[model samples]
Target: MSANGLPTDRLGGNYFKLFGASTISNLGDGIGIIAYPWLASAVTRNPLLIALVAVVQRLPWLLFSLPAGVITDRYDRRTLMVIANSIRAVLTLGVALIVLGKQGVLPSPDDIDAGAVIGTDGFLYGMVLVATMLMGFAEVIYDNSAQTFMPAIVHKGNLEKANGRLWSIEQVANTFMGPPLGALLLIVAFSVPFFVDAATFVVSAALIALIPATKRSAKQTDLVERRPWQVELKEGFSWLWSHDLLRPMAIILGLLNMLGTLSGATLVLFAQEVLRTEPYEFALLESGGAIGGIIGGWSASRIARKIGSGPSLYLTLLLGGLTTFLIGFARNWIFVWAMFAIFMFFAVLWNVITVSLRQSIIPNELLGRVNSVYRFFAWGMMPIGAALGGLTVVLTDAFASRDIALRMPFFVAGVLSVALFFFAAPKLTTERIEAARTGSG
Candidate 1:
């Protein structure tokens, strides 16, 4: 038993190191959460341009996930994580410098509003696009490697517990602590938060570098032969496609992510215009997700055991539609806040269960490739969704009020989520999951 009376013997030093790095880096992400979107909104109120930033940011996942998987499988996972973060640090610093030079001309955070007619700062906007795309590529590699790296440090039996704890703290940093701080930093200057964000990446990279190298088993070594990239990629793709449960699950997640981006594509505008929120209030909006994520992360295992994995997932899908619809109709930021809290609770629940399930079932040698392929299905749709989301607003604005146009995506996404629940009901079940666990599926 550890100091908190929870088992710690099974979770060694490396797990804590990984946990700390994730937490600190997520703090930077939390800052970016406010800084990035707010910066885009300041540059141009055009919904398409704003959405383009998101599309470009996620484009790499679609383009690079398969190749990134191959790289993860080919290299040392820890070293890959360090290098990815280091690159991100460098790129973020460049953003800070660029923003510093232009801070004099950019609109003050307080003056930026949904109704403001601002000319697009082509130079800054282009830079945001390029930096986000590069960072997205780095994120793909770091994320794929990090997930695969987790299994090597912690015992398999403790995977759920470890993942749960990791996510909880990450949520706290990313949403709870970081956004409010980002809001404050914006008061100082746009570049200040980016500088802090860069520093956090540096710290995270150093921590990851300290983890001792993992020794591969003879079986894993033999399995991870130096094969052609195409062959290895095909192997991972075939494994996931052959699995009945994972195939549909990945597809379902892809649709869900698409729907999420659809509503979220123009969220900063919605918050500014529809909800009439200031920067601090907007940051407060994310706090709801932080709270929900914390609760869901800590309690997911218990919820899964109590309701069964199938029902837990059903709850996520069901609540996802309901909460999204509620947010569509909400005029007050507090109401939106409540919806965010509820929506994130189920979202984190889905992640905890699904991610843990994958880690438990997938073979070690194929973990990186398979997880990347799974993400390819899971995350690849985001850019597409982002594109549709932007188009949805622009097209809707032609016939309807801007407020109505802003709210349309949420309504559409809600209906799609409910329809998806019916489709997913039969495919994913507690029995199938248990059978897969026992190697009998």
Candidate 2:
């Protein structure tokens, strides 16, 4: 038995189930993540349209995240996970059917090159946009439920280890295995990848359903569901906003996400024009990050123990700045890939620390709502940043060449991340992290 008075075997067993479910779901996400933009690029070459697809997909974070959080706290988390995956499964199959119908009219996936499609059907573009939006909405619910669910399953002291394993497995599946396979599937048939994606979600839902029920806090039984959601929502917001450590972290994370998306929203174009990669090569580019993520996931806990959480955040920002700056000017595919690897390594380390910290600090009953509110600040800026990327291109089109304009967002992202690093590193001291850990902040 562990110190928490549960059998160590049972805890490990349950976490393995959760890890299995998450790994399968993210594996599917990795495939779809590649397929969606690939399909969008096929349907339209306009940078703004591509950005619009990204924007629409992320818009759910702005619209549904807070409410989703409340729903997560109010309902059975496992049930929510099942429902979210089921929604994704159905929607993804729908997209596959659409793609299958266009097999003759659409260019063969293998025949297409990296650059923009010459002309694409308007109807197809609309379908891609709508499908992506719906999938993103489902993802919002699933992710929030999944994150909050972690605390219920794992012992508090093991949060970092559990998180590291989860993050590493997710990265390996999403970036390392999924994308390259997706590119290969695309080579065989455009619709095949989507069908596989749909199947994975179905399997993931089943896996989640198999996880044993976790104990809920006694405090929750007294607070009936009939109470107003707004009251709880306000409590969540207040909790996050008032926390000295979480508030600054959330704000800085929000800015970083926005900046990251500004460049990421137009990555397909950059891969094509700057790196001059083919479909398979483009997928391989992501593998660099996957490799780095594996290392980061394994090392994050140890690094935090050595340097502390505050310094870990600082390191993430510094690495992120270096990544963006190099990618902005990198003409060689090798150079770009190396930079991506470095960036993702640190990104995973940062996630491990931050996620564990939140899981450790928040009261279980409030976890769902507060996690949602935190994401509202951190992720809400993604759509805005995506829009900024497209807008940057449009605004600069007249003054500079298309390639240069497309590259501008990367440079801007780099500059902003570096500036924030300087501002935040000083404010988020080691003392603050230690205070939060002790519940004294």
Candidate 3:
């Protein structure tokens, strides 16, 4: 199916080029999660420090995402992506070099190698944070621009099918290949996956360069007519404000986003303290979720085609929440693996369905801006959720009971998803969705 929300004649043409680049970029992202955290944790065993790493990575979106979105709407998405990719490549290579030097694997840095690990007397943590922020800033720009660019490349009728394919590939890269392979490379060299990420960014940039669209012309724009950044930011939110299709889905996903964060942050604790699993075994258990996501991705397009996107989301999301709720009661290895797999499957379903709907309804002219606004909200609350989970353990007897601390986050995450389901269902109907898709086409 084409990516324009129309019926699929077939899936081919220029859109495939974007998919190729996305595959490479996504793999790097998945691998980054493993490599980055492991490197940081290797340096500092403190849970707070590990959590701080996540904070550094995600904080950029909350701060500058709106401006990044406006740029995507106002400029050449393809070119912005090229710049983002190139910059990411440089950062990844620099980090890789430093880590290699620290490990004494680089052989010849001599005096420089001594300064590599704790560079600038631990100032590199801040530098790493800054780089993470820039990388995230660029991510918001690239993601927004890509949303705008996708519909332009393919027909309107097949947005769901096309998005499904992309989601499937992302699931494979993220859940399947990223973690396991990253662990293997970490065994070989601490910075090996980062080096791979650097290479992928270069390749992604090259693939993005292959698209036929010309650079956006600044001369054609009316600079004086542009609204203030604050006003423009509000304008983007307002676009989704009165909409029938996107508004409800956004709220539903927003709650899940929060829940996902809480559940994710506490998962390692559950594995380590509750399940008594070895570190490597915990890694294997974690990968089970990704593997489940792969299965869900494989089936998602078929499910959506049979039941429709809105309905599929409605159903799978319920499953996702239930899975979260079930996490608290988990007792043994069997249950841990089962809950993880179930959680991953439903999460993948949620991702695939929502993306299809957004691509189908959002106007191409406003696509980048609207998506940026969506992301800023949908992703912005994750840090808060993480903090809340931490606090919940601190304030209550949750941690003392061990099980309470370990399981409460899961229950909260699940209930949040369930609560949002009712709020979303009445607003999201198959009829409205089909109409939106038809109108867009």
Error in Å for residue 408 of model 2: 1.1
Give me the runs in candidate 2 sitting further than 4 Å from their true place: 2-11, 109-111, 114-117
Error of 2 at 97 (Å): 0.4
* Model 2: per-residue Cα lDDT over 108-134, one tens digit each: 545456243468679999998898889
C-alpha lDDT values of all predictions: 0.90, 0.86, 0.69
lDDT of 1 by residue, 32-129 (tens): 99999999998998999888888998899899999898888877899999999999999999999999999998898778853666899999999999
How well does candidate 1 match the true structure in TM-score terms? 0.97
The alpha-carbon deviation from the true structure for residue 27 of candidate 2, after best TM-score superposition, in angstroms, is 1.5
Off by over 4 Å in 1: 1-9, 219-225
Report the lDDT tens digits of candidate 3 across residue range 188-243. 77768889988988999999999876444353254215666566667778888767
